[model samples]
Target: MVELSGKSDPFQHSFPNAVFYIPALIVVSAVAFFGYKLYKSLTEKDRKREEKLKAKQAKKKK
Candidate 1:
């Protein structure tokens, strides 16, 4: 016959550890998202500057 212990399942102990990591994961994700956005914004700004410079040069050539 198989024996079953009355104590809580071993898996239950890991639940708290899992929960504890949730906040850390969320914080890391948020930082990564913000960092990506900042990088994108900077890249866009640089592109716009390049376009402006090209336009100015074109005007001078005319």
Candidate 2:
């Protein structure tokens, strides 16, 4: 015959879940910040390039 302990499952008492979530949250936050910065910089460059091309075209018509 086997007997079960009255205590809860062993996993419930193990290391806290925050140990994994905290580092993962930090990494994800860093990636998002850098990704947004890169996106803004690329878009700004494209906008400036487009404006220069338009100005050149307008000058040719005058």
Clashing pairs in 1: none
Best by lDDT: 2
lDDT of each: 0.81, 0.84
Which lDDT tens digits does candidate 2 get at residues 18-38? 877889999999999999999
Residue-pair clashes per prediction, in order, are: 0, 0
Per-residue alpha-carbon lDDT of candidate 1 for residues 1-62, written as tens digits (9 for 90 to 100): 22244356663222446665789999999999999999999999999999999999999999
Write down the TM-score of every candidate. Answer: 0.72, 0.71
Where does candidate 1 have its weakest 10-residue lDDT segment? 6-15
- Model 2 bad stretches (over 4 Å): 1-13
